[model samples]
Target: MRCYVVGGAVRDRLLGLPVSDHDWVVVGATVDDMLSRGFRAVGKDFPVFLHPRTHEEYALARTERKTGHGYKGFAFHASPDVTLEEDLARRDLTINAIAEDEHGSLVDPYGGQRDIAARVFRHVSPAFAEDPVRILRLARFAARFSDFVVAPETMALMRQMVDAGEVDHLVAERVWQEISRGLMSERPSRMIEVLRECGALARLLPEVDALFGVPQPAKYHPEVDTGAHLGLVLDAAARRGESLPVRFAALVHDLGKGETPEHILPHHYGHEGRGVALAEAVCERLRVPAECREVGVMTTREHGIVHQAMELRPATMAKLFARCDVLRRPERFEQMLAACACDFYGRPGYDMRDYPQIERLRVGMRAYVGVDAGAIARVLEDKSKIPQAVAEARAAAVADALRAA
Candidate 1:
């Protein structure tokens, strides 16, 4: 049996990148062959095993045939006859199809090394169209390797796949998984650009797709186009090394503006209220985790108010703090604020300007936290009045702090 290091580990190593995990392809090996060697069976659909010592994944060299829709519609054929070249041919990208043998001899049957040197993303074969998830993975790779451009043929093939309605069959979980990873990349906007270019954005995220042509007030958003503004926000979040929840919040924060009335023409008044529902809908549709959903929804609803932090009255600040449940969930509240900061910093001539609004809100939060709400509740004669009394005390404290500041 021949074992070779295949896929990302080889690709990353060839590119002088840090390799974290290694995937091995065992050619001319059967399940029994692996089992007898002390390897543990782990793969559900095909023949995959874990090394008894290193615990790394070892998948038997296999070939597949398209049997149905999406990524799940495939029939695998693994046997001692399967060649290393055949297994590499099934990979999505040429750059990922390279393999290395135990003697460190490199295998480049598909010109993966050439494509890597050229910084181009090319599909392995015509079989690339069989899996819809490849499009998302290509986009994510663009995000990570921001300098690489998709090959014209590959882009055309992906467009054809989208036109054929293949992308529509992708499972929501896979979509979320790929998109969330793309959002956290160093240049997340590249992922969005690739998706929009291939027409997958409209199919997967029509709300975000609509924002590309939408107009925004040029004074506040020097970028002028809401779609362009969204890209900037995502990149800004990435530049700041923000978390997944913060990045996700940055993604859907402006979706409400896409639904703005055309007569208003660049003025998105009341878009926040509209945005809350749209953001909530996206979170639900994607099955986004609770932390990400809460931050996204709250950022959508309160970012506009947050932008006007310096001008809001003490009562308004207190109400905003209470509504966001900042005291109970400080970390999430901070993530929402980080999302808002990205929105403000994403525009031209504003990217480096001071964001005093964040500090203003921080001052208010400190005052609100300083208020002894429990003490107020303890002294209240009527239990029902406790909430109102605590709110009054918090507001008064905020007012004093603001006045002092």
Candidate 2:
């Protein structure tokens, strides 16, 4: 059986990035042949196996035919006669269609190497429209590789796909996967622009799309509209390469602003709370992970907590930390602060001078609520007597610190 490394592993290696996983395409081999060769047969619908030695995935050369609708309704053909080139050609993107021989010889039947060199993302074939998830993948690729632009023909195909209602065929899980990856990328804001151009954003996140032309009060948002302000925060958060939940927090932190009442002096009095509910709805709709949903909700609900903390007494600081112990990690807490900061600073007409006050508030909170596990535990144990619990918890925490020191 002849096998060659295919898809992302080869593409990532060519890009000089760390390849975490490898997928092999086995030509001239059947599922039984792989099983006989010590590979573990695993796939239920397709001929896929895990290599006995490397534990890498080895998918038998196969072709798919659409049987019904969406990604799930696909019929696959796997035979010994299938070639690696055939399998590669079936991929969505040109850059991902390249394969590598066992000797590391490059395979570029579709000029994928040239496209990679040109820093362009192109469709391998006009058949890209067959799978609607490719549209989301294209947007995500744009976000991940900011230097690479989608080829014009590919963009045209994407628009056609959307126009044909192919996007409606995608499952929520696949859509969320691409979106989460884009949000975690270095140019998530750019992804929104790309999605908008392709009409994918309107289908996936109409809540966000609704903000595009909605005008915020000029006093607070002078740079552009609400959409532009949100884009700025997304761009800033992407630059930071924060964790998935944190990045999501940043991406959707101000989603409630669309519902904010407009007036002479516009203000979203409880937008943070509104945003929490919206974010939860988004998570439910997208079927995101529970932890991610929790973090997103927390970030949105408490996006303004840092500002409120600034005007509080020491007791308030103690109480606030006790209440939000879920934000124990310094990085996580900083990410929350960054989400808040980006929301405030990236607004259209925000006054940069006001940041000093915010920074002062952040610094005070950090200093006052230095990690006190005992305080958190006491607060958790005795919610009835908060003051006494805080005193005991503080003393216990100090003793523990001294012991550690």
Candidate 3:
């Protein structure tokens, strides 16, 4: 049996990128052959094994045919007769289809090296259109390699797939999985743009897709619309090295703007309140994790108020903190502020602008936490009145802190 290193490791190395993992394609190897060499079978759907020593995955060279719909509807064939070329032919992208043998001899059956040099994302064959997940993966790859562009033919093929209702079959877990990874990339906006380019964004995330042409009341930069602003926010979140929750919050913080009435034009007076429910709907639809959903919802519900923190009354600010559960969960509050900062900096010519609101919120957080709620509660005999007294004390403490400043 001959083993060839294939997929991401080889592709990343060819592009002078740091290789994180090695995926081996074992040609002319059977399940028993791998087991005899101490490889543990790990893949549930196909013949994939883990090396006993390095623990890296070693999948047998195989070709698959689309049996039905979605990504999971496929039949696999793996045997000693499967050729390396056959396996590479079934891969999604030409760049990932390259293989390197044990002697380090490169095999370029699909012109992966040429495409890599051209900084292009090209599909390998007609089979590329079979899997719906490939579209998400391609978009994610665009986010990672910010300079690379998708080939026109490949883009057209993806559009065809979308038109054929292939992407509509994608499940929520898989959609979230790919999108969350793309959100963490260096240029997360590219993922959104790529998905939009081929119309997958409209099919998958109609809420976000509806935002593109909508106008916002605030135009910090020349960015045309709320959709352009969303792209900027996503990239800004990535630039700040934010966690997933913060990034997600930055993504959906403006959903309510999409639901604005045409007569109102740019002004979305109560978008934040409307956005809270819309954001929650998106979280529920995507089945996002609780942490991400909570942060997304909070940022959507309060980002407008957060931007106006310095102007808010101390009582109002205290109510904001208390409503956000700042005393109990301060980290979530911090993430909310960070997401708001992303929204603040996302516009053109706004990166240099000072966000004094964040500092004010931080000061308020410190003062809000400094209030001895336990002490105030113990002194108050009426338990029902304790909440009101504590809230008043907290607001007063914040007022004093702001006054001293």
lDDT ranking, high to low: 1, 3, 2
Per-residue accuracy of model 2 over 1-405 as CA lDDT, tens digit each: 888888888888899999999998899987778888899988999988998889999999988887776777788899998888888878999899988888989888999999989999999987688888888888988888889988999889889888888888888899889999998888888789889989888887877886787666677667558788888888766655567777788767777876776662256678787777778888988998876776677677777766664455545544544555624554455566666766676665553446543455445445445555465666475666765655555545434433343
The worst-scoring run of ten residues by lDDT in candidate 1 lies at 277-286
In order, candidate lDDTs are 0.94, 0.76, 0.93
- Candidate 3 residue runs with Cα over 4 Å from true position: 218-221
Best by lDDT: 1
Candidate 3: tens digits of C-alpha lDDT, residues 1-405: 999999999999888889989999999889999999999999999999999999999999998988999999999999999999999999999899999988889998999999999999999998989999999999999999989999999999999999999999999999999999999999999999999999999999888999999986555547859999999999999999999999999999999988998899787788899898889988998899999999999999999999999899999999999889997899999999999999999999888989999999999889999999899989888899998998899999999999887
Structure candidate 1, residue pairs in collision: none
Model 2 lDDT on a 0 to 1 scale? 0.76
CA RMSD of all predictions: 1.0, 5.5, 1.1
TM-score against native, each model: 0.98, 0.81, 0.98
**2 versus 3: better lDDT goes to:** 3
For residue 349, give model 3's deviation from the true position in Å.
Answer: 0.6
